[model samples]
Target: MISEGRYKNQKAIIVENENLSMSFLPDTGANLASVVLKEENFEFMVQRPEREYRRVEFGGDYVEAECSGMDDMFPTIDRCYYERFPWSGTELADHGEVWNLAADVNVKGDDRVDFTFHGVRLPYVFHKNVSIIEKNTVRIDYSAENNTDFEMDFLWAGHTMLQAEPGTRVIVPEDCTCAQAVFTDSGRIGAYGEEFDYPVYRDKDGSLRDMSVMGERQKDSEKYYLKYPLTEGMCGIERTNGRSFTYRFPADRVPYLGLLQNFGGFREMYNMFLEPCTSPFDRPDVARLMKKNCVIPPRSAYDWYLEITVR
Candidate 1:
């Protein structure tokens, strides 16, 4: 049923059933605040303690907001120049403009909830629907429609930052391949642009590091983007306590998978993200430069969906 709950100081809508439950905050970028597996008593998404939502400054500065929950990163992830100045000539608000703007929640109940946001900086409307499909499963469907006369380039990703314990490990499909490192600024144990089989990576110091398990490590962060046309559209985290959370999607629609591990590197908390993306790169300009940005035709709509399950 749909009811009001407190997400820190913000109000959130709670939707649930006998097996699973979810919370969403419309004011704070329509963030999926929490996903709970009732039987297992596990919370899949992370929540940054003592964080408050604030407007993201014009240049993608993300210091004002919390890093928890599942947020939609769209339009542009990195800073890019807009030919037209709706406000500023640059389109860069850290993860994107969608995360700060308030979204309208139109439907809410035990089975499904639909929310939508209209972009102020870009000419498009985004819609997302979350539904309970099975006892241990939930599906999230997304669509973006261009409202402008010209084509636009953008990036989209499921910023699913998950909770992890010391013995937790991320599992990718057997045939999945990824780069040694993607986010260069986040510090890396390996060289940039080197290709590696999933899980095992070759560090720059000629050392082999296993990327799967979240062992006891110092302050360090690593990120990698899965190459286009993935062999399989599935990945998950198996907790040390024996619980598992998995995400499945259409490989053709979601072409990229990203692994983000921050082991006390950026903050005091240790968290991991198994991101499914429509585009490969995080930087909008870089993605555009590398021809990896998604192009939406004028007056057209794009749609896709993914499923999350616990077992």
Candidate 2:
């Protein structure tokens, strides 16, 4: 059965069943909001304004994105302006042809809660399923569906923001590396240098001590394809004083990942963003070049999935 509850002054919904026990924040402006699995003590916060927005936070565990929410230029959080369909209401549905979508919530079991949404024109749909089992570990599944006339341009980029403190180190698989940092504007020093082969290193002072100069790679500006190969399926950020939370994505389904950090400010400060994107930003042209962007066949459906397991 589904029930209503409250936590930290936020309104929430609870779902319970034999296999799962889930919780959700219905009043928040987040797409999927908060979720907890029955078998685990770990809870997943999809969009918590208290911590930040457009970013997911794993409580007592780890923070996900770097600079989440609408870009500083666009501060409203009503709907995702970039989404093919944007919905501001509490229900999910097909708004129309002009990029309108909805956020829908459902209870499948006594302890399981599911959040679903659809993007028209764009060959993709988002589904987040959370189940609480028993070991304080919550099972989270994030899936995207393709629903278009032809294979469509696709990217599952998540903007997660982490709180900054000393001794924080961003980690990735030994085999995987980061592309050089791209500056949104010119004149300022970029976060990481121009090399795309090695992991970007940072010291406690938050300086790019390894590389003297930043490299210029306009792939996203030209066509948008930011991806790093992950054969092991796991990477993470660790805080020397606190705990480390490993971020995992299925390698078979998601082959590309992006890491961003905004410390001090967009110009300077200390923050890290770990993104898993199916395609790069604003590179519709590259999608055609690489044939990486998907096109949904007329009236057909395509589905994909990702999960976050905290320990």
- Best by the TM-score measure: 1
lDDT tens digits, residues 241-280, model 1? 8888899998888777888887877666788888888887
lDDT string, candidate 2, 1-311, tens digits: 56777644545566445434444544332223333444454333322445333323211111223223211110111122332332222221211111112347776766567766555434355566656554434445665555444444344454444443444666666765445444433313233334333444553356543321212232221011134456766655665544444556676665655555443444243444555544433233343455555433445543444344433
Clashing pairs in 1: 60-94
Question: Considering summed lDDT, which 10 consecutive residues are worst modelled in model 2?
Answer: 69-78
Query: How does each model score on TM-score?
Result: 0.90, 0.60
- Please give the clash total of every predicted structure, in order: 1, 53
Whole-model lDDT values for every prediction: 0.76, 0.42
TM-score of 1: 0.90
On lDDT, the leading prediction is 1
Model 1 ranges off by over 4 Å: 51-60, 83-89, 184-187
True-structure lDDT of candidate 1: 0.76
